[model samples]
Target: MSEKNRQGKRTARERLAEEREKQKSAEKRRRVLIVGASVVCVLGLAAVIGVVAANVGKDDGSESAGPVVVPSGAKGKDSLAIPVGKESAKSTLTVWEDFRCPACKAFETAYRPVIHELTNSGQLKVDYHLATIIDGNMGGTGSRTAANAAACAQDAGKFTAYHDVLFDNQPEETDDAFAENSKVIELAAKVDGLDTPAFRTCVEKGTHNSWVDKSAAAFRNGGFTGTPTVILDGKNIYQDQTMTPAKLKQLVQEAAKG
Candidate 1:
């Protein structure tokens, strides 16, 4: 081969190697940039989550900071449960409920009759724990206010009747009607002897607001996902799709026999 041709071939091979090295460098830089951007995105998301968590903590603290005026004759841990039947009843139904929750209202509507019958017959007792989750989610005080009024009724020795009246006249979840003390007092007129001055004062002043907040905190801390969490004799009957008022009555009757 001619010397000039050999020299030209060597130069061409050197140029090709240089070109490949440039491409490799460019690819490495591109990968680094992509990783950096991904890290930045992750950090940004974490910061946002932190801010949201802090805000939630602050709100919860503010809501829960007050005197917890438990209702008269309240039962259970922290006196957060309103009892509705003879203590000697064979079965106890634990109900975690929210006043402004539509599902809770539905459950009450469907089960109220059977529950009343069972309680009246001294076969079953119910421990009602009130939560204000709807107030937290929907941005209102109706749930807490209504709960306070119910507590006042408990003090008046008319909790069951007032509770039924409240459920029967529950406003829409989005409607803050129950937030108005007058509205709750108006509903109290439906319950005999529940519209007295002390009841009105308790309702207006939100005497049990802190207690209600504590109950809501308990509902959340208990790992419950939603309202109307109905547990019959330690079994969560509400989670069973086949559960009905008749089934509930049958369960209570069986418990009574045992």
Candidate 2:
């Protein structure tokens, strides 16, 4: 065959090799984009949240009883105690998660039914420590914005619902991830007793900005270097490659058995 004719066809193995190379390149670019976006989001908005929070002097309507002290189980670890769910369970489960983290989303979805069963039966209470892990993964303010929005829903006792919506309607991580205003409203509307005027006011001026920053500070100060970290009944569990949610639930159950 002529040189040009010979080049016209390739074996299946050769084609497969080419496709694998393309996939590897795509994964590399994706990793870089996620890191760059997260840094920009945190550096820009975290500062803004600090400034806004300082100006409020505690009038932001998110006043908790006092500064949450890390429990003995999660001692020397990074964590926060936000009363998520019904706040009335034999044992409490605290999670530090980024709204935009896919693993976080998966856990949220996977554990929903169990949570409902636990909360309804008064077996478990869950607290979410919202961390901005994705600000470094996705290149935008989506993580920060989503964190603040969660706080806003939290005010109305609707965080669980809003939490689900955020992960459900999540856009691909990019500069545009945080620009969709309508999605915020859609999530907010689902929150029961979420006053439109008050919620709108909070969202408009980003009232919940402080909560996001404060949570991030807690994560850093508490020594957590990653998102989706859990403090179950006071023991910190930094998941390794072998970790699974079933094992986590087993841990929770065992802790509660005591």
Candidate 3:
């Protein structure tokens, strides 16, 4: 073979090797960019979740008297419960719930009427503790916002009606739709004479946000986990897996008999 032909072949091999190395380098850079972008996106989402969880329960440091959703017939003005029936009732029923929780909606649907009947008949008075556990778990402000709106409704003396309506119109657990102020106002209309401008302004300004935070804090401090937590005579009977609304009413009646 001629020397010139051998030289040309060597140069050709060198060029092909250089081209392959260039291609490999480009692919490596592309892979690195893709992985880096994915990691950044994940970190950003996590940061947002943390911020929302922290801010949802923030104390705004206002000394304003909290929402007055307690019924005219209720007792204990200083506590978190909006009482129904006489304070002299034989039984006290405490319920802890998050408006955004599906399980709570199920519990509400099953037990609301029974509870109403008992309260109306003067057999029991209920203490409602609103919680924002779903907000912490799901990483959004929907639960907190909804709780705040309910507090505002409490100021209108429509806590029970607005409370029931909130559960009735509860969005899917994963959705943050309740975080919108308008939605709560819309739900307030379901309660007769509840959608007043004062209620609207209170909800829009998050006037009860701090109170909602306090209530949520009480729930956490109460050492109970999860929503739809029901306590009858200071006992956690709803923890039983088989307990139903009918069973709950019977238990309340039985407790009253004691």
- Whose TM-score is greatest here? 1
Off by over 4 Å in 2: 1-80, 85-88, 192-195, 238-258
- Write the residue-wise lDDT of candidate 1 on 112-215 in tens digits: 99999999999999999987776666677888888889899999999899888888888876798998999999999998888899998988778888888888
> Counting only residues 3 or more apart in sequence or on different chains, how many pairs clash (N, Cα, C under 3 Å) in candidate 2?
7
Q: Best by lDDT, which number?
A: 1
lDDT (Cα, 0-100) at 234 in candidate 1: 92
lDDT of model 3, residue 250: 86
Q: For model 2, how does the per-residue alpha-carbon lDDT over 1-258 read when each residue is reduced to its tens digit? A: 886666655565689899999999999999999987654442223343333223222222233333443321222234345565444465777777777665565555555666666666666777777766456443456776777677777665676777777877766544446434456766676666764776666666666566566667666566654556666678654343334455656665665677
Residue-pair clashes per candidate: 0, 7, 1
Where is model 1 more than 4 Å wrong at Cα? 1-62
TM-score, model 3 to reference: 0.69
Give the per-residue Cα lDDT of candidate 1 at 112: 91
Q: For model 2, name the residue pairs that clash.
A: 34-137, 37-139, 38-135, 38-136, 73-234, 74-234, 78-222
Query: What C-alpha lDDT does candidate 3 achieve relative to the native structure?
Result: 0.74
TM-scores for every predicted model: 0.76, 0.61, 0.69
Q: Any residue pairs clashing in model 1, and if so which? A: none
The per-residue C-alpha lDDT of model 1 at residue 227 equals 67
Ranking of all candidate structures by their TM-score, best first: 1, 3, 2
Query: How accurate locally, in lDDT, is each candidate?
Result: 0.81, 0.60, 0.74
